[model samples]
Each structure stands twice: as C-alpha cells, then as structure tokens.
Target: EETDFEKTIVDSLNIGFIPNFLNSFLDVLSTASIGLFSVLFISFFFLKDSNLLQSGILAFVSSDSEKRTVHSIDKINNLLSRYFVGLLLQIFILFVIYTITLFIVGIENAIVIAFLCALFNIIPYIGPIIGAVIMVVLTMTSNLGMDFSTVILPKAGYVLIGLAVGQLIDNFFSQPLIFSNSVKSHPLEIFLIIIIAGLLFGVVGMVVAVPGYTAIKVILKEFLSENKLVKSLTKSL
Candidate 1:
C-alpha cells in the first residue's frame, strides 16, 4: 500500500519537474556550502591575528603618537565588540519569540521559518519585510492541499501577527537598549540617525547608519577633540 502511494505520487509529478528541482536544490546547497566554508576560513585567520589591526596602525604612526593611536584602536574595538555582541543577543531573542509564536499557530517547520526571519534582522528595516513575505509563502506552501479558510488563512494570519509583535518588541525594547548601551549613544540620537539615513539612502542607509555614526563620533573625538560639536556628540564615547 505504501509502495503504491509512493509510486502514485512519483507518477503524478511532472517528469521534468523533479529533475529540475533536484538540480536547483543541489546548486543552492553547493553555493551555500562554499560561502559558509569561505567565511569560516576568513574568520579563523581574523581570530588568530586579532592584533593585526593594532600592528597595522602602529606601523603607520610616529613613535610619539603610538600611545594615542593604541588608545584609539582599543576604544574602537571595545565599542564595536559590544555593539556586535548585543546585536547577536537581540537576534537570538527574536528567533526564540518567532519560533514559539509560529509553533503555537500550528505552522510546519516553525523553527526554520523563524530562524530565517530573525537572521534577516541583521539587514535593518528591509529585513523584517522580507522575512514576513517568506513566512507567508512557507505557511501557504506547507498547507497547500488544506482548506483555505480552515487551515491556510488562520495559519498565515497567526504567523503574520506573531512576526508583527516580535518586530515591535525588537524595535521598541531590544534595539533601543542595544544601541544605547553598546554604542554609548542616546536612544533618541540613534533613532534620528536611522530616520535620516533611511530618508537619504533608503534601506542600506538605515542599516549602516548606526555603525557609521559611531565610527564618525570616535574618529572626531580622537582628531578634533577641541571642536564643540565633536565634544557634544561624543560625550558618551
């Protein structure tokens, strides 16, 4: 009986579809594997030579300025490390929230969908939109043969609501805390920067705004300590 069911499914599928799907899947897997390996290989070297940036800086600076240069480098490293670590924690928290919510909604592969969406958080404003779209697609496909009203609509609606709530928490609580504590910037300052960046350059602008602003503040404080604007902007730093 099981053999007949399997045979029926295989025969019902378009002959070319299976081959094409397998080929596409294989290609994607191969590409992802290569990229993953490349990142790991590069990360290993970066970790092993953690002092590479300091060494490079020292090599470029005069002997008399070495101390100040070292101080600046250390400050930048500390600030960036905190920012990145906080970002990771925020993403993890969001992932857990999304997974639990989707599971409650009776979505299949809830964990996987939630993970992808949470990971997209790294991309800033555009990430959530993309994640939500992906979630809806996954939910619909998972219930492909089910009654639309009874299964699909409810599942998809719940998934979307969950994503919306998760994003709200992230934006209001997680993001503000991370930006304020890690970057030593005021929540209002971070908010304004993001808004301005989005206005000027769209999604990419918003994504890079915080780090870019932090870097600028650090550099200005280091080089233009006497400047009034620099003093005010970098007081926290």
Candidate 2:
C-alpha cells in the first residue's frame, strides 16, 4: 500500500504538478503586481499632496486643539516617511547580501529568490524565519538530484550563515538606527512593542506596530506633555 501510494504521488507529479505549480505561481504574481501598482499610485498621491490627508484628519480635531493637532500630524508624517524609506533600504541591503551568498554557493535564480526572501523581512520577528525556511527549501530543491547529506546540507548551511549575518546587521545596526532616528524610540521599546502587538493581533499587528506606536507617542506627547513617562519617551521627538 505504501509503495502504491508513493507511485501514485510520483504519477501525479509527473502528470500535473509542474503545470499546476506554474499556474498557481502566475496567479499569485498577477495579484501581487496589481497590489504593487496600486500601492505606488496611492503613495505617490499621498506624498505629492500631503495636506489632503492632513486636512481630512484635522476635520475631526476640536478648534482649540487644531494648532497642536497640526503640529503632531506634521511630525508623524516626517517620521513615518523616514521610517518607510529606512525599511526599503534595509530590504535592499538584505537582498544584496543574500544574492551574494547565493551566487557564491551557485544557487539557481539567486536574484529572484534573494529579493523574495528579503521582502519577507518586512514582517518583523517571524518574517526572517519564514524567509529562512523558504530559502532552505528552494536551495535544496534547486539541486534535487544531488546527494542530500553532502551537497544540499552544506549549501543550505552556507545560506543560513549568510542569513544570520544579514539578520545581525539588521537587528543590531539597521533597526536600532532606523527606530532611533526615524521614530525616536529605543530599539528595546520597539522590539517589545512589536512582540506584544504580534501576540495580541498577529502578523498585521506586527507590521503596523511601529507606525501605530509612533503615532500614539506623538499624540501622547502633544496632549500629555506633563506626564513623566510620556516626556521620557517622546523627548527625542
């Protein structure tokens, strides 16, 4: 029965797997392409006409707090813009590092794989783990017929080491600098916020944690200027 089951799987793969995989991949790619263009257009509109968002938001502000609200909004906009640009640079740096490592290991389609994996790093704590798993799976599959113990394991190990280096730089250097300079928060504060947000609200929470936290800090500083904790947190802002 086991042999028969194995044969059935092999038959399915031989008959339909490649085409099915390609079709599914194309579907995902098309959707992602559409999302990418939509995001670009929206970002361009917001960046070009920044006051449109400000005006819309300010409509809800009380007349007494209007001046303070406008100041907070300006600070939020500047900080978030820097934060996002820093994130893009971080991903690009990882992509370059991963590409170099994959090329050195002679991995096929290194650039595309590296870029995809690098993009995964945007998700915070869990992102790198997912990227590493995908990287290892792709690396092994790229050399499917090779000896698993000798060729595949060693190559995957090399890629893992490369990933570790990229992660170290991101965690220690890139992240701290981005958080401090862009958002005016301690690395530890941002890390804790991201973890707590992830636990409570999942991946989406983690993705928005920094921006949300930064906005909150800005608001708190504006309204609670006399509070000691708020003063400490937002002093750098």
Candidate 3:
C-alpha cells in the first residue's frame, strides 16, 4: 500500500519539475550574485570614504539643523556599530552551543552544521525556527539508511531538545542583554516593532527593525525633543 502511494505521488509530479527547478535555481543565483556585488561595491565606497558620504548626506540639511543632523548621524552610527557587534557575539555563542550539542549527539560534520545554523539566527523572529528545522533535517540525514524509528527519530529528538535549550538561552539572556545594552530598547518593544514591521513590510522590514527603530528614535529626540511621545520613546537613547 505504501509503495503504491509513493509511486502514485511520484507519477503525479510534473515531468518538467527537474528542469523547471534548475531554471528557477539558476535565476535566483544570478539575481543574488548581482545584488551581493552591488551591495559590496557600494559598501566598500561608503566605508572607505565615510566622511564624504556624510558630507553629501548633510548637504541636504538646512543650516539651522546642520549640527543636530550631524549629531544624530553620529549617534546612529555608534548605536548601529554596537548592535552589529552584539549580533556577532550572539552568533558566536550559538555556534559554540550548537557545536557542542551536535557533537554530543554524534552528528556528522557537526562544526559545519552548527556554523550554518548559527548564521541563520541573524534573521529576526523567524530565523531560529528555520535553523531548528534545518538542524533536525541534517541530523536525521546524517544517519541515512539507518532504522528510522530506533535511530533517526531519537537522534533528531535530541537535536531538537538541544536547539530549544540554545534558543532559551538566547531569548532569556543573550537577546535581552544585547537589546538593552546596544539598542537601549526593551525586548518587548523590539519584539513588537519587529512584528509590526514584518506585517507592514515583510522580512526585510523585520531584519532592519532594530537598527531602523534606533535611528528613528535618535532622530526624533534630536529634532522633536519636546513632544511627549517622542520624549517617552527616546528617553532610553
């Protein structure tokens, strides 16, 4: 019965599936490569001549607000630098924990798997779930051709538990500390901002939420210090 069901499903798949998938993959790869090169080129120039970039940006500001704008830019730079460094630290912590967990579970290529999974955690909100899925799939596949119920299931379950533990540490300890120290926002505040940004602008919005929110808060405080809401929100900055 199971063999018949499997064969039926296989037969139902479109004959062009493999070719279509290859075409789509190549298209995506080309797009990604172009985007990556563009970003790197721009970023190289920006970093190499940041003062020139800053001067160009400040050229649009009125003389009256020039000083304030400069201050806001500096503040934003400092906060974002710290936030990015904190992210690196977070990834490192996750890598260490994941490597240890995978090693204990006897998974093959544990270091590489842990590193890839750790990198995925950079995406806000949804990244960890994606990482967990990848980890479990990799763990199970490491024992390919083994007995599924006795070996693969138990190993995958252990990997899942380890992922939960790592995430708990990240949630309860790492993230809160990073948010408070680097961005000067509460975890709940950041969480709500990410969710709202995700709803309004999708994954890109969520990815940029923390640094974007921090920049906005800095600008608001610099320009609208007297407004009650702005004052309340920017008090942390």
Candidate 4:
C-alpha cells in the first residue's frame, strides 16, 4: 500500500508539473532581471545628476521658501538613509543569531531558514511570529520520520527556544538602538507610534510608522519651529 501510494504521488507530480514550473520560473526570472536592470540604470543617472534634480524641484517653490525646502529635503534624505541602513543592520544581526542558534539545534537548511526569517523582520510586531511559525513547520517536516516523543517534540521545542532567544536580543537591543539613533525618536515615542499605527491599519501601518513619523517630524520642525509641542517632539530631529 505504501509503495502504491508513493507511486501515485510521484505520478501525480510528474503530470506536466516540472515543465509548467520551469516555464513559470523562467518567466519570473526574466521579468525580475529586466526590472532590476532598469532600476540600476535609472539610479546611476539619478546619483550622477542629483543636483540637477534638486535644482529643478526647488525651482517650483517660491524663492522665499526655497532655502527652507532645501534644508527639509536634506534632513529627510539623511534620516531615511540612516533609518534604512539601521534596518539592514538589524536584519543581518538577526540572521547571524538565528543561523547560529538553529544550526546548533540541528535544524535542516538552517542558513536559508534564518535568512528568510530575518527578512520577515522588516514587518514590525507580527513578522517575528510568522517567521517562528514557518521555522517550526520546516523543522517538523524535516523530522517527519522520527518518533513523536523521542525526536520530534524535543527537537521542535529546542528550535522554538532558539528562536525566542534571537527575538529577545532583537527586541531588547537591536530595535531600541535603531529607533533611537536612526530616526532620532525616543524609544517610548517610537513604541507608541507603532502601537497606534498597528491598531489603526494593522501590519502595514506598523511597517510604515517609523518612516512616516520621521518625515512628519522633519517637516513640522521646518515649518513650526516655534510651536512648543513641535519644539519638544522634534528636538532630536
């Protein structure tokens, strides 16, 4: 029966699957490559002639506001660049921690799994939970043949523990530093913004909250430099 079942599964998979998958994969790869090359070409020119673009944008503003607009643009650029770099660094740190921990716990494809989980950290609050679920599923499937008591539960538990540890490090250390330093917001302020955004718009809101908050703060500081609340909130910016 087992052999028959295996053959049936194999036959099913063989029925036009490989060709269809290969064709779709090739199409996706071609499209992605084209898009990537286009972006690179445009970015190269943009970087080379950034001043021209800046001057053109400033030309639209009245002469009196041009200086303030330039300052605002510079501040926004600096803050966003640092914020993105900090996020990248956070992901790298998480990837390293996860890879080492999962490998130590004997999970299959630990490096790839870690990389994926780390990338998911780009989405705030909910992303780590999703990554952990994926890790557990992968680990359980890898150990499918093992006895449930002796091998499966214990190994899965160990993997979960490792993930929890990595998350702790990320939450307590990496995140605070990124929010406080990159966006120049107090950790508490960032925490509140994320919570409010999550409540209002779910995961998408949480993901954009920090960048949006930073941009708003910059603009407010530029225009409302004398307002007391704005003065306090945007002091760091």
Estimate the TM-score of every prediction. Answer: 0.74, 0.80, 0.81, 0.75
Q: How high is the lDDT of residue 228 in model 3?
A: 100
lDDT of each: 0.77, 0.84, 0.81, 0.78
Sort every candidate by lDDT, greatest first: 2, 3, 4, 1
Tens digits of lDDT, candidate 3, 38-100 = 533553564467688779988898999999998988897788777877887898999999999
TM-score of 1: 0.74
Task: Write model 1 residue lDDT over 14-130, tens digit each, in one string.
Answer: 878878976875564444334434533553454356589679869989998787777776676677667877877888988998899888877878888888778767666666766
Q: lDDT by residue for model 4 over 101-182, one digit each (tens)? A: 7787788789999988887776676668767877887888888988989988887898888788888989888888888888
What is the C-alpha lDDT profile of model 2 across 1-237, one tens digit per residue?
469889888777755677897687566444444544454466557656879988998899889999999899888888888988898889999999999999999998999999988887877876787678778889989989999899999999999999999999998888887887899888889889989987897666777788889989999999999999988998988
Error of 3 at 122 (Å): 1.6
Model 4 shows how many backbone clashes?
Answer: 0
lDDT of 2 at 59: 90
TM-score of 2: 0.80
- lDDT of model 1, residue 19: 87
Q: What is the lDDT of candidate 3?
A: 0.81
RMSD of each: 8.7, 5.5, 4.6, 7.8
RMSD of 3: 4.6
Ten-residue stretch with the least lDDT total in model 2: 28-37
Worst 10 residues of 4 by lDDT: 31-40
In model 2, which runs have C-alpha deviations exceeding 4 angstroms?
1-49
